[model samples]
Target: MRTSACVLALSLAAAGPAIAQDHVHAQGAHGGLGTVVFPNSGKTAAQADFIRGVAHLHSFGYRDAAIAFRAAEKADPGFALAYWMEALTHRHPLWGQEDLPAARLALSPLGASSQARVARAKTPRERAWGGAIEALFAEGKEVDRARAFADSMRRIADSDPADLEASAFAALGLLGLGAQVGKGITADDAIRYAENVFAKNPKHPGAAHYLIHAFDNPVRAEQGLPFAREYAKIAPDAEHALHMPSHIFLQIGAWEDVVASNERAWAASRAWAKQNNLDNAVLDYHSLTWLQYAYLQQGRFRDARALIDTARTLMASGPANARYSLWDFWFQYASASGDWKSVSVADPLSVDEAPDAGAAFPLPDMVQAGVAAVSRGDSARAARILSLLKARRATAVPGSYSNNGYEMGVALIAGGIARLRGDQLGAIAFYSAGADIEAKGSPAGPPIIPPVLLPYGNLLIANRMHSEAVRAFERELLLRKNHSASLLGLARAHRAQGNPAAAMQAYRQLLENWKRADADYPPLREVKAGASSSPGIILN
Candidate 1:
């Protein structure tokens, strides 16, 4: 139950020098991971810097890469490749965000169209790269553009088997394509592409980093561990590289590792912000949110509270995006700790206070407010919030999956209120609607914490609907195994249904899963104590 700052200090003291030395060794001896060369760009000091920028780009260090690319441009004003990369840094293809205006400005001097840009290229390969990126910015749907870009990069890589840089970029483009359409490049495909580059350059940052991203899900989390373990060592200065390992750790419920990884990443982000003379840093908020989540999971309430304060202070200085992180961290901490009082005291999102256009949808905050009202027996307040949520859903843009998801969250809150009012059938109907929405799957990434289905199932169990409760818990477990609450609920539901053996089995699994968790964690302590009293149950 260490504070995040203390954990970071200890982690850096124990591992920092070794990681820095590894990076030094890789780049020092024999010019390790030889310079990436574009066939058309004449070899110069500026081009060397450009190549370094490309390496950073591959590792997803867009800001740093952008800086380096700008420096390259300063060194050689006519370096079209440098300008191209500088523009590329503005777009996050996988995340579906693009600063199109910035990109267009960067490419302004080059040409107006893809063909025009290609025509300006001094060499065929340069033209190919220019044309590939042009496809990304072309007038089309993002998914279509991503597919075309991936195809173009693939052709570039196939044309020159010796250009490991091309191959690495092609792999990233494929990932972008997959992310756009939600499926295409499998983990195996990612591994294959990454390993191909690793065979030629073992210390390649992108190869290590993307390999982790490729397998950053529950089923394949362990497979990414090797890359996750090595990426920070390969690129210690990149904030994203330091943070990426936690994606795997979180999936496997390695709370301490998750805490340590994000702590280091948060420090890196702060240092970067200070060095750049920026008033705020986005990555700081990102890492802090993850760090607080780990602290909450380990039952370090005091530490988690400190993090909440820190996040609030950061939000005051940071950009609009930081508000999103602040709200997410606030909601997750309150929900996980079951501190409805805090949720009740929380301010609702006013239109003026909305972080962005997307965040103007107030269903998330209303959902929490409604839940807190129900918990506090303020049925009128809960009903008011539910009405507001329903009206919002009604006016939400049709066919928008995000809006539909919000409506589902609305259903959940309405159901909770119904349950509080003792209307069992109404509660079940609302809960069923919410569950149906979840069944359609999330359009975005997994949430920072477990889904609300656990509580919905617990409500069902309260009404003696044990079988339905068990199914709900099991469904949540499918999305995130080793979720402590879901496991405990499943166990209790089995017990309520007169299945002693199944209950005991679940209790044992919970015990095993939480063996390494903080001893003070309430769920872990509850399971341990409960198991001791269960007939024929044994604790290892």
Candidate 2:
């Protein structure tokens, strides 16, 4: 199964690799691929594919970009810029992943060195751009290479001030350097460069797409909405463009927008995969995952569940990461719907028992699955899960995502184990320690399971800590607005604390959030019946 842009770049790509034949797939499958004004000296025959390739590259449509760039190379064999973009197809900046060997291989057909490749270019700007792309694949600490790349990009943008493409690429270089918009330095610089390009060329896919990645945070997601909205329409041929808007929608709790965007993206990906005779890896499972999560947020429980089987089937032959996404669908449904019966192939509760059982960030969903076992008096299973978490923690690189996740998981599950053993204070200590970690938000960005806050809140309620439970639920809601579980917990805790008005307000908001929810959803039934915490069972 081909991995990377599930969909092809242009309609002519329908013919696959021989896209250079008379029906060269260059001007986007749809003519609305967006306006890019790059005046490179490559032959006119190569420009269409080169422009399309640059657009796809901006959208992170790495595979399609590779196809288009290769088409450009075929059209004009000495188009060194074509080779430069093709090399970039192997380096996914936003994902923090790269294939240096593949990038070097892409450049090999052009020349043995960066200088040799630049010598093939017809103009100074083209030569300068060549140097920047060379630095992009250079050997050094990733941070240092990123800085070098950005520095060269800065020089190019400055020299060819009229080239919006260079400015957009410069903005991307800043992002690759971890620059945050408005945070100043390279940070302030990225926003200015991208925004400048965007203001001039609103239809430029690269400018819009880079701006979205630049401003995707809770504080500034609103700033990305304009670009996010325009990007997909500008490049409907690219699945990543359709899916990229959700990063903003998610930040702003725009669940309906997220649902709509990913629905289109996943469908496009599915169609492409089917046409290409590829399995799960060709499908946009990431968009599918986001679509399912959006369904859950909207209380469309049945719809969300329907997607899990589809996810598992489509991603069946995919790699561990893809299979983990299937597991995510399973875990999200199970967590949101409160279904604690059994495990599927994604087995949250079932231990791998393999010696190499981890890429390790002891999934919080797995932790809660163990807690569910404890709820059923399965101490042995809980202990096994805890032991696995501890081992995962031991293996984690300090301050990495895995390290943070495992550290967080250990605390929450240890709290559960402590509670199971009737060590109430010990349980509180563990949960409290985990709370401290969550507050830091140190690993950066968001988590798949959101650090298991609602369960912790539920645990507090089970222990009769009404005030703390209320605080926990509020904190969770702050992290993600209108979270149904957090709303339910908040409602319960408020009632327990003798704040009927506050409880009622929360219940009303929850009901509004669930206006279209599955009628018989367990939480819906509970809230309808004015059901509060049982003082014994944690509604985790």
Give residue 37's error in model 1 in angstroms. Answer: 6.9
Question: Which candidate tops TM-score?
Answer: 2
Q: List per-prediction Cα lDDT, in the order shown.
A: 0.67, 0.73
Tell me how far candidate 2 lies from the true structure as C-alpha RMSD in angstroms: 7.7
Candidate 2 clash pair list = none
Best by lDDT: 2
| Model 2 misplaced stretches (Cα beyond 4 Å) | 1-26, 179-188, 317-325, 346-402, 442-446, 528-540
Cα error, candidate 1, residue 528 (Å)? 2.6
lDDT of 2 at 525: 68
lDDT by residue (tens digit), candidate 1, 1-540: 211110111111222221110111212211222233333343354655666677668766687678778877787676677778888898887655788878878788777776777787554566677788888888888788878888887776766555665677787887887776554344466566777776777677888877877777766778878877887777776678788888778777777788899999999888877777877645467678788777765667667777877777776675756235556766677766776565322455433232233235445566766666676777777776666666667766765654665667677677777887789888888878777666555322236323567777887898899999999988877666666667788988888887877777777777765565666665665577556654543322
Worst-scoring 10-residue span by lDDT in model 1:
3-12
Over the stretch 175-201, how does candidate 2's per-residue lDDT look in tens digits?
888731222336568888899888888
Clashes of each: 0, 0
